[model samples]
Target chain A: MAHLDVSNVTKRYGDTVAVNDVSFSAKPGRILGLLGPNGAGKTSTIRMITYIAVPDAGTVRYDGRTVGPWSQQRMGYLPEESGLYKRLRVKEQLVYLGTLKGLSEAKAAERADYWLDRFGATDWADLKTEELSKGMQQKVQFIATLLHDPSLLIFDEPFSGLDPINAELLRDIILELRREDRTILFASHRMEQVEQLCDDICLMANGEVVLDGALRDVKQRFGKNTLILEFDGPDTFIDELAGTGRVRVNTRSAHRAELTLADGADARSVLDLALDRTDELYRYERVEPPLNEIFVDTVGEAEARRMQHESVTGTA
Target chain B: MNMSLRKIWLIVRSEYWRRVRSKAFILATLLVPFGFVLVAAAPAALGYLAEQNSSKTVAVVDQTGGQLADSLAAVSDDQLTFRPVSHPTDSVRAAVRAGTYDGYLLLPDSLLTGKGHATYYGMQGGGLTDQIQIEGRVSEVVRQQRLRAANATKGVLSILQSDVSVQNRTIQEVGTGADHTFAYTAIGYVMAFVIYFAVFVYGQYVMQGVIEEKSSRVVEIIVSSVRPFELLMGKVLGIGAMGLTQMVVWAAVVMGVLAGAAPLLALFLDPASLGVPADASSTAVAEAAGLSIPPVPYALLGWFILFFVGGFLLYASLFAAVGSAVEQQQDAQNLLLPVMTPLILPILFLAFVLESPDATTSVVLSLVPFFSPILMMLRAAITSVPVWQMLTALGLLAITFVTMIGLAGRIYRVGILSYGKTPSLREIARWATYR
Candidate 1:
């Protein structure tokens, strides 16, 4: 296992900076969630760490040495795009990929069979990739990524095409790999899975890192600003809070509502108002915001800033 | 090899074996020679069958008062039997219409004048050999009759009949090797075409292989394991090896056919009786005579392969870069014309090389790196290229191959990741120089 260190990595394509002044590092045997919306430089940063693209102004080091072909054997990457050969058999393609990643032929074949069976795809081992469904191909590709037993694994959008069951299967395998002390990093836009699976989370927007730290610590920094209210009454009280400057109601129903406290809002005063209006108040509490809300708020603010900047500068 | 090189070799090995196992490869390799055999033997067999079934019965009219008609043999070799028939021209036409005769030869009695036309009517046309035989017989009889009537001296008449033969000898001027135009031209075409065809055939393979990686998006995954350049090289060299193996199989089959089918072919064509070209190289003619067989040009063949490999690598590298620059096969179709121009140019100039292998234009073209692979093969066969020229051409070609590989590697590195739209030539060139 190896720690992946990426510092001040910047990549520019023509006039657009795809990755700008981004930095992230991972200790060995930990799952790091790389999160971003579209074109938010998540892939760019991960690509640098994987050594697929050289950073323009910073270094990507594994175990304090710069990444190169030697580092490749210790790393596995599954890019978002589907890549299995259509004409190749699942077993043969897996073995070929394993051998490419530094396994011996026999060892590759052995691991390939093992992984195929583990993924519940042994029955399709001899069948061509095209004969299998997209979900099945995704399964075989997942096996390919893990076939060489690399020290560090990187999966980009691993659950995109997977059915719920296969997604759960992948989640279990990733957790299993972590238990076996394999360092893992996966990038995705889906916040829930990241919240469920990550130990360290790095959120990016507008080619820059927006929020990154231990998952709990990042949530702690948000400081329980979300208000959850449930009561047996009409939902007018939720609307009454919507126009109020103290909170923004994210969702509402007749008897339940979730809201985020605006800056300088007092939760006690809000609770007092809710008690004043509602007869049977079943619940009223402030909780730490979910990763999804944080992600949307962060990305939305960054996008707004970019739009403002583009209008001010007259540039795209 | 080192670890990375070994990985590249794995790429090469898989690419080769994959194609080697393909049904297209097997069918092409196994069926082409048999096709050639069928094509070569079909016409000869059909002609023989037609000949055995055809027997022309020609009537002879005694319009010459037995002057020309008496000279013609009644049953001329059983191929065309001439029977004397006392019938007028109108009656002979009637017989011809009734199909009483296959044809009739009307000999006009112009008192032995050579100006009178002797008309032979036939239901159908004959082969060249048959026509020539009939023309020869008539001409010989007429000549003998004229000679007798002229009362010419025997020596004068005999000398008039003899054909003057010319012998060709080459005094070495600027080169060595055989001056047999047909043989040298044949070798030049073979060499030029092998290099041209092999380069084209396998170069596209390299391109398609790259497109495969890119379109499937395996390139990013692969680059994670090996450099983009390694993948490209592995593919280029791998596909080149496939083509080389196919060509070698074809060459072996050709040699086998040449050796094993000669006796069977000899039954159809007799070199001595049919009169092989007098000016053909004595070595080839001797073999044609079933005399002392000449040695194969192992050195020339070595040069042929050396040039073929150099050309294939250079073109294959460029083609691979083009493959990466495009997102789909349709995008690549537009890009191939420019890449194929250099390959096609030498072939277009092949005639120039054949006509004067030592001409200054030919020499310069054969020395030019882009044209050298094909044109030099032509020059080597037709004339003894200076050792310096061959080495210089090969050196320039090797240097070109290396330079192109470096450029192509850069293009492949970045272009593999850039998808969706095809880049312009300028954009692709920028990619080559990017990092």
Candidate 2:
């Protein structure tokens, strides 16, 4: 059974539909990327899942049953803007959070110590949170989230203030959690990070998921229209070259040009023709579309369609 | 342990340690005792030192050459050196304006004729004490002159002094319960003001704590793990514990100081030698005058802990709840007024009821749980309070404590995550009713 299944969820903030008909399933050993633009209903969905706010419509299931107090016990959440008491020491704050998550005093203290050591923050045990830098505070917050060893974890923009090294360190730790067969849901706009971490992805736009699937499958589907080319001279050459497919230049330089083989353009045949035109080509390879491009294309297309419909209805 | 119990303990620990260690709490706790000592002792200390080191010069301007000046000299504190001024009244005013003299008194010519009125020239609003001293001297002169004219004997003066004498004491046998000691009354004032102060200090600590969490959006993360009730209770209890610990330390310090200084107080204040006469009529006079022995310190201390904790928790919970309900400190003012009004009314009523802890006053203040702890402590200090009444007031207070927690929790649950306009009373009511 899936560890978490949020089905047909809808939430409204007064007249604003924050989350609209959202559905996703996070199975054990899987990291599901809940992707969205700012205010794109990702927080609303997470809030509903955590039971911080009740869903106006839909059910959030844990295992096979719907969410309940028992589910909340095993669920860990790191809110986007959460902070520790400014005057409280890092270790004490984590211990308090551990106790709140149902750890016994001894267990909480033990876990707090372990997490501090893991984050290389043992020396910071007695230092108030206010004394720690923003990156260090982020590490403490991360440790607090995982100290309880919750089966299902959700972190909203957990990498915000972290430096690259610490961010990678946190990423490795998240991957380690995934290796332990824990179900994780992370919301981030960093596509590269999401691509590296997520097993499945749900892309939310305008309070709705425009696209969702296994990460590899989604990338494969998104790859069909994109192509890469290597040739001498400028990109204007490819734009003028007639073909069975639409030619969109991906990149152009003094010595080489890259193109997307839109629709039916055979990459090898197109390259063969390009070879006939120039011989200075070094290498040409087809690669999967970057998640950022996919996001932009998908959200852009959806928005354009909406605008067209709105204009017809005089609501533009 | 269950989350509620664990969270509450955590909260208590958090509130206790965080606030107790705070410079603000330390400053506030120390402010009260220091303020009391300064207000009570500064004037006496200053006056004593002034008498020993410097003479208070008084300028006497006599329009008529009478023996009024001589009478004024007789009433001097020995350190008060009177300077006779034959100059115009304007000169005396200039001297006073120049700060040369504390004050000047102009005696009218008809002073001996019983139609005399004294014109005191100085800062009109200022020099009240100076005016009082001068008045006392003038009255003594008038009395002496009238007595001499009427040819009154010393027996008459003796009779007048004896007729107006007041002797006061407590009528209790050895130790029925205990007389309302001045010490006990002091404890009441201390306890009342302490509770008043501690509740605000600790409650504001809890309030600010909640506001910090709420404003930072940290409460959403916390409330996910713990119930609002546990969080509210934990904060109040923790801060209240810290306050009590500080209070005990301060009390111990005060007791130590008093114990070490008892002999000095006896030497200087003459307290042990200060006693009413042993006549039955004097005792009766003492009883009628409402004089009593000090309140039992141990009893008052016990009540102090009870009422202080109960009083602090009752208010602190509401304070925390209010903090949670609002996103900003400015919004908190809306919720703050209703909770504070009840507590303030009791404090304001303390003055009027101090002289008369009548049934009406006692019943009115004591029945209301908000006023009960402070008012009941006062009544208990001044007069006998029935055990049944105490129990009833305590029980009602306990119920009030529970009810406040319940309501505060409801508001806390809804308000912790709420932002923008402060919730109205109707909205809070709905939250309370939300099952």
Q: Which candidate is the best by lDDT?
A: 1
Residues A213-237 of candidate 1: C-alpha lDDT, one tens digit per residue: 9999999988899999998765676
lDDT for model 1 = 0.81
What is the TM-score, restricted to chain A, for candidate 1?
0.92
Model 1 lDDT at residue A312: 47
What's the residue-level lDDT of B130 in candidate 1?
63
Candidate 1 wrong stretches, greater than 4 Å:
A230-240, A252-256, A266-283, A301-316, B36-46, B49-179, B268-296, B359-361
Which ranges of candidate 2 are over 4 A from the true structure? A10-17, A51-75, A104-107, A229-288, A297-316, B23-31, B55-198, B250-293, B296-308, B345-366, B370-401, B419-435
Q: What is the lDDT of residue A34 in candidate 2?
A: 89
CAPRI accuracy category, model 2: acceptable
lDDT of 2 by residue, B316-378 (tens): 888887888887778778778888898888899787667677668666786678888788878
- Cα error, residue B395 of model 1, in Å, equals 1.6
